[model samples]
Target: MIQLHDKQFVPFISAKEINFAIEKMVSQIEDDFFDETPIFIGVLNGSFMVVSDFLKLYKKPCEVSFIKLASYEGTESTESVKQLIGLNQDLTGRTVIVLEDIIDTGNTLEELKKLFKSQNVKHFKIATLFFKPDAFKKDLKIDYVGIRIPNKFIVGFGLDYDGLGRNLPEVYQLKEE
Candidate 1:
C-alpha cells in the first residue's frame, strides 16, 4: 500500500498490464489511420505520461499537441470543465485524435466536443488509456479505450490525488477504510 497525503491506496494495475493495454489501443488506431497522418491532442497534466508512452509505441508519422483542461478537485469530478490552454493549430478537414489518460465522468470530453465542433475538422476520435463505464455520464462514443475499470477512485499512472502519485509507474485504487 502507498499513501499520498491523507489517502492510502493499493496496487490495482501493474506497469506491464498498462503497457499491454496501450499497445492494443495503438494497434487499433494504426489500423484505422494507416493511410493518413492524424494529429493527436493530448489532455494536459494527467495525460503527460500516457502521451509520452503512446508516441514511443506508435511508429507511424503523426503530429501531437496538448490542451489543458481542469474538472477534478481531489478525487471527485467537478462535472464542469474549464479549458486552461487552447489549441492554435488549423484543424480544418484534418483527422484529430484526443488522447486522454482517463475517462470517468466525461466532463472533459464534453468540453473537447464543444471546442472542436466549430473547427471544421474532418472527424475527431477520443482515445483514453483508462475508462470507467459505470462513472461515465455522457453519451459520447469513445473510439479507442485501453482498459475499462470500475467506478473507483484511483491514482498513479498519470492519475493523481491532490496532485500527487502521477510519477508512479503503476496504478493504485483507493484503500477502503
Candidate 2:
C-alpha cells in the first residue's frame, strides 16, 4: 500500500508480474526483429524503467533514443499534448519502435505517430507495458501490449501521480473515495 497526494492506493501489480511480462515482450521483440537492427524510441520519464529492463532482457543489436512528452497534471491527464523535449535523431529511413510505460487515451501516441511519419521514418510501431483498452479513445493500433488494466489512477514502476511514487517496484491503484 502507498499514498500519493492524499489518495490511498493498494498493490495492483507485483514486481514478479512485471518481470514475467517483460520477459514475454522481449522474446517476441527479439524474434520479430532478429534480422533487422531497429531504433527504440523510449518515451522518457515514465518509460525509463521499462525501457531499461526490456533492453537488458533483449539480447539484440538496436539503437536507442528518447523523447519526452507531458500530458498529465496531477492524477489526471490534461488531454493536451505538450512536447517538453524533442527527438534529436535524424529519424530518416529508420525502423522505430516507440516504447511507452502505459497507453490510456492514446492522444500522446497518436501525436507522436504523426510526427514520426512526417519525419519519414521507414517504419513505426508502438510497444507499451500497460494498455487501458476501455480508456483509449483513438483508433490507433498498438503493436505490442504487456497487460491490459482498467481505467484506474495508478502509480509506481515509473508511473507517477504528482511526480511521486515512480520509484516503487510494483504498481498500485488508487483507493475508491
Candidate 3:
C-alpha cells in the first residue's frame, strides 16, 4: 500500500502489470510503424517514465522529443490545458507520435493535434498509457492505449499528486475519504 495526500492509503498498479501493458503497447506501435522512422513526442512530467520504458522496447530507429502541457490541480480536472513548454523541432511532413500518461477530457490531445497541424506535420498518432472512457469529453481517436481505467485520481509511474509520488514504480489510486 502507498500513502498519498489527505492521509489516503491505497494499493497501486503493480510494476509487473505496468511492464506487461507497455510490452503490448510497444508491439502494436512496432507493427504500425515498421517501415517508417517516426518522431515520438512525449508529453512532459507525467509521461517521462512511460516514454522511457516504451522507447527501450522499440526496436526500430526513431527520434524522441517532449512537449509539456498542464491541466490538473490535485485530483480535479481543470478542463483546460496550458502548454508550458513548446516543441522545438520542425514537424513539417514528419510522422509524429504523441505519448501521454493519461487521457481524460481529450482537451490536451485535441489542442496538440491542432498545434501539430498548424506546424504542417504530415501524420499524427496518439499513444496514451491510460484512458478514462467515461470522462472523455471530445471526439478524438487514440491510436494506442495501454489500459482503460475508471475515472479516478491516479498517481505513480510519473503520474503524481501535488508533485509527489511520480517516481513510484507502479500506478496508484487515491483512497476515498
Candidate 4:
C-alpha cells in the first residue's frame, strides 16, 4: 500500500494488470481505426503513462500529441474543465483519438470533443484506461475503455494528487481518512 496526501492509504493496481489491460485496449483500437492513421491526442499529466504504453502496442501508423486539462482539486471532481494547455496539431479532417487516464464526470472529454468538432476534425474517438460509469454525467461515448472502477479517489500510473505521485508504476485508490 502507498500513502497519498496525509492520511490516505491506497493499494496499487500492479504492473501485471496494467499490461494486460493495455493489450486488450490496443486490439480494440486497431480494429476500429483500421487503415486510417489516427492522431492520438493525449490528455497531459494524467495520461502520460497510459499514452506511452498504448502507443507501443499500436500496430498501425499514427501520430501523438498532448493537451493539458485540469478539473480535480484534491480527491473530488470540480465538474469544470480548464484547458491549461492547447493542442498544436492541425486536426482538420484528420482521424483523432483522445487518450485519457481516467474518465469520471465526462466533462473534460465532452469539452474536448466539442473543440475538435469546431476545428473540423473528420473523426474522433475516446480511449480511457479507467472509467467510473456511476459518476459519469455527460452523453459522450468512450470507444475504448480499459477498466471500469468504482467512484473512488484514485491516483498513480500518471494520475496525481496535488501534482505528485504521478510517476508511480501502478494505479492506486485513496484511503479514507
Scored by lDDT, the top model is 1
Write model 3 residue lDDT over 104-177, tens digit each, in one string: 88888888887787887777999998999999988889999999998877899999898898888988887786
lDDT preference between candidates 1 and 4, better one: 1
**lDDT per residue as tens, model 4, 1-177:** 776567464675787899899899999889988889999999987999999999999988999999999898887888888999998778888998899999999988888887787788878889899999999988878888998999887888898888878988877887765
| Stronger candidate by lDDT (3 vs 4) | 3
Off by over 4 Å in 4: none
**Cα deviation of 91 in candidate 2 (Å)?**
1.8
| Ranked candidates (TM-score, high to low) | 1, 2, 3, 4
Return the TM-score for each candidate structure: 0.98, 0.97, 0.96, 0.94
Task: List the pairs of residues colliding in candidate 1.
Answer: none
Q: Candidate 3 at 118: error in angstroms?
A: 1.1
Q: Which 10 consecutive positions of candidate 3 have the poorest summed lDDT?
A: 3-12
Clashing pairs in 3: none
Q: Residue 170 CA error for candidate 3 (Å)?
A: 0.6
- Kindly state the number of residue pairs that clash in model 1: 0
Task: Report the candidate with higher lDDT, 1 versus 3.
Answer: 1
Measured with C-alpha atoms, the lDDT of residue 105 in candidate 4 is: 90
lDDT against the true structure, each candidate: 0.94, 0.89, 0.88, 0.87
Q: What is the lDDT of residue 24 in candidate 3?
A: 97
On a 0 to 100 scale, what is the lDDT of residue 18 in model 1? 96
Cα error, residue 44 of model 1, in Å, equals 0.7
- Residue 106 of model 4 has an lDDT of 90
